[model samples]
Target: MEPIDDLVGRLGRWSAGRGPLFLLLATRLRQLIDDGVLPPGALLPPDRRLAGALAVGRTTVVAAYDTLRQEGRVVRRQGSGTRVAPAVPTPGPRVAETSNPLFLHLLDAPDDVILLSCAAPLGPPPELTRAYATMTLPADDLGYHPAGLGALRTAIAGRYRSQGVATVPEQILVTTGAQQALSLLTRLLVAPGDGVLLEAPTYPGALDLFREASAGLLPVAVGPDGLDVDAALRLMERHRPVLAYVVSCYQNPTGAVLPPLKGRRLVERAAALGVPLVDDEVLADLTLPGGDGPAPSPLAAYEGGSGEGGVIGVGSLSKVVWGGLRVGWIRGPQPLIARLARLKAVHDLGSDVPAQLAAVRLLAGFAPVQAARTRALRTGHDHLRAELGRLLPSWTCPPAAGGQTLWVRLPYGDGVSFAQVALRHGVAVLPGRTMDALGGSGPYLRLHFLLGPEALTEAVRRLARAWEEYEPQPAAPHAVAPGAVPAIVV
Candidate 1:
C-alpha cells in the first residue's frame, strides 16, 4: 500500500461543500467505491498514518472509517486495515433518485481547524495527576464488581450534601457515563410505547439513546426561561408519560437555565401527574463566570427524606472535568439506585475504577474547574456574541448567560443547509435537527462558544461562510429534476 500519510498529504485540499472534511472525504469515497473507482478487494489508506499526515486526531480518521463501514461501502480488516467492500444490488429508482446520500460523521475532527463540533472542551482537572498517581484500585482478585464502590458513593454523596442536597451515599450509583445512566434508566422504566418527555432541542445523544430504547418522545418546547411547564403539563396530563427527562440548568443547545422556582415547579407538576422526572444536571456545573449558583436544590430534594415522588438526578464529570473521565452517577432513592445498579451490572459491570478515583479526588477542586470555565465562557461568549451581533446581526441569540453554547436562529432560517455548507468550509457544526425532538427544527444552531479563543472565532467565521453559500441555492425541487424528489429524511 502507498504510505497512507503520504496519501493523506497527496489528496487535494478537498472542498467541504456538503459537510466537514471527514464526511466529505467519506462521501466522495463512498461514491467512488459504488462506481468502482476503487474496486472490491482494493485497499483504502490506513487510519493512523492518514491521521498523522492530516495532523487531525486519530478519532477523526476512525470516524471516517466508521461512516464507510456504516454505509456498507467498505469492509475493514483488523491488522490489514480497510478495503472497498463488495457492492450489493439496489432498487431500480430513477437516475436522479438513485444517487446515494451518505450519512455525515457524528463525531469528526476537522483539518487546519479549531473544532467547535465536539461538546467537550476542557482537559482533566489539574489535581488529576496527583489524584491518579496516589490513588490505588483494590488488590483483590480480579472479577466483575457490583455497581460503584462504597468510597465513590460516599464521596459523591458528601459532595452533593455540601450543596444542601443531602443525597445519601447509598442512593448514588456510579456509571460509566451520564449517557449510560440515561440508557440504564430507560431500560429499567421505558418499554415500547412508553411515552418519554424530552425538552425540545435537548441533548441529542440522550434523545438518540431514548429512541433506541423504543420509547415515544414527547417534546416540550424550550425557551430562555426553561422547559415550558404549561406545555409540559399538557403533554404529561395527556400522555401521562412514563418518564420526562430534563436539563433544568443550562439546557443543552439553548443555554437556558431554569429559574429556581421553575426547577421546583417542574418537580411538583411531574410528581402530581405521576411521571418520574429524570433531571440531567450534566451541564449544571455553572462555569459562565459570575452566574448564579445551582438553582434552589434540585427537584430530587422533593423526594429527599424518604425518597417518594420519583425525581431521579443524573450527573457526570464529562462536561466539567473531562469526557475521557467516563464517570457519572445518579442520586435518587437508595432502592431505585439499587435497581439501576442491577441494570448496570448487565451493561458494563461497573464504572471504570481508576477513573472513578480520579473523579472523587477531582470533585474537591470543582471550584477551580468551574472558575476556569466560567472565565472562559464569559470571555468567549462576549467575543462570540459580539461577532454574531456584528456579522449576522439580524438573528436573535439568547445570551449564553452561562453554558458551553449559544443557540441562535439564523436570519434566513434553514440551519440544516448552512450546517452542510459549513462542513465544506473546513468546519463541523451540529444542525438543529440533531437536537430536534422529532428531527425537525426551529431555525436554531447550537454554537459552542466554549472552544479555544482562535477556534471559537474561526467557527463563527465558518458559520458566516456556510450561511452565505447556502442561502442563495435553489430549493431541492429546482436543484434536481422535477421527478427526482429529494429523499425522505429519517
Candidate 2:
C-alpha cells in the first residue's frame, strides 16, 4: 500500500488552482490507478487517516472516495476501506505493431517533433565543414575510385599504425558507411543459415543485415560489466559461428565498454575456437571527458599475437566527425581486404571521393574535434540524466560512459507502449525490442542524449507529460510493452 503522504507529495502541479480539491485528488488517484502505481486490490488508507496524512479535511477524503466509488474505479467494503477497480478493456490502436522501426521514418517527422530514435550527433565538427570546403578533388574527370582515395586510406592506416598496429593502405577498404562495409562482409562471411554470434542488444542495423542474409544467430548477454567472456567462449565452441561481432568500446544503446581483461579473453578465445571476430570501433573515439586511464586497446590489437588472423576492426568517422560524411573503413589482413574490396567494387563502385578528402582533413584535426565532441556529449548526457531525475524519477537510466544513447528501463509500462505514447506527445524514441536479436528486450527504451541541455530539458518535459497520460490501468498488466584493399586509387 502506498503511503498517503507520499501520494500527496507527488501531486506536483496537479492540485494548483483547482476549485474542487476533492475532485482533483480523485483525478490524481484515478491516474495513479491507471498508471499501475496503485495496483488493483491495493487497500487505501482509512479516510480519516488519509485526511490527516494529506493535511486535508476528512470530508475531502470522503468525497474523493465517494467519487471514485461512483465511477466504479474503486470499491468500498465494510472492513476494507477501498480497493482499485478490476481490469477494463482499453480501446486504442495497437502502437507496438504499427510503430516504425525504420530510422529513416523520422527523417520525415515534422520539424517540431523531438526525434529520440536515431542517435546521430546534432552536427558535424566545424573542422570537418572547413575541410570539405578547402578540399580539392583531383583534376581527373568523372572520378570513379572503386577503392577509396589513396590519401584517406593512408591517413586511416596511419592512425592504426599509431596505435601500434602495423597497417598499410593495402589492408584497408573504405565504403559509403560502416553499414555498407558490414553488408559486404556479411555477404562474404555468412552464408544462408550460417551461425553468427552477436551481443544480445547490439546495433539494430547489424541485426537487420544478418537477418537479410538468413544467418542463424547466437546471442550472448552484455551486461554492465560488458560481454560475458565465458559465455562467449562457450557459444563460440558450440556454434562455431562464421563471424562474431562486438562493440568493444562505448557500445551502442547501453554504452557499456568491454573491460580490458574481457576483451583480451574474448580475442584469445575466439582465436582458439577459430571464430573470426568483428570489432566495431565506430564510437571508440567518443570516450567521456575524463577517464581512469587511456581507453582500452582495440580487440584487433590482439589479432597479431593470436596468430588466427580473425579480428577485423571497423572504424567510422560518423560518431567522432559526422554521420552524413559516410566515411568508414575496415582494417584486417591484406588477403581479407582484397576479397572484400572485390565484393565492394561489385556493389557501389566506390565511396564518394570528396568525403574521403574531407575525412582525411578531419583526421588531421582529430584531437581538437574529438575533444569538442566529448565535451558536448558529456554535457548532453548529464543534462539528460538530471532532467530524467527531476521529471521522471521512477525511470532508471544509468549514466553512459560514452556513446549517444541511454538504455532506460521504465518504471511501470513496457517500451513499445511508452514509445507509442511518446510519439503522440511529439517525441520519437527507439523501443528496446528492435535491438534485441532474440526478442527478449522489452520494457526498455533507448533514449539519445546528444541534444543540448535546453533541448533535453524540454524533451524530458514532454516525456513526463506522456508519462502522465499513460494510464497505469492494470489491464491484466498488459505487459507493456573490413578489409585490406590493395586496389589503386582512380
* Best model per lDDT: 2
**lDDT on C-alpha atoms for all candidate structures:** 0.68, 0.75
For model 1, the run of ten residues with the poorest summed lDDT: 476-485
- Model 1: per-residue Cα lDDT over 18-45, one tens digit each: 3466775665455334323244666877
Clashing pairs in 1: 16-424, 17-424, 19-423, 20-423, 287-374, 289-374
Question: In angstroms, how far off is 488's CA in candidate 1?
Answer: 21
Task: Compute the lDDT of residue 252 as modeled in candidate 2.
Answer: 72
Clashing residue pair totals per candidate (backbone < 3 A): 6, 11
The segments of candidate 1 whose C-alpha lies over 4 angstroms from its true place after superposition are: 1-108, 112-114, 141-144, 292-296, 438-440, 474-490
Residue 308 local lDDT, model 2: 28
Candidate 1, residue 126: CA error in Å? Answer: 2.2
Worst 10 residues of 2 by lDDT: 481-490
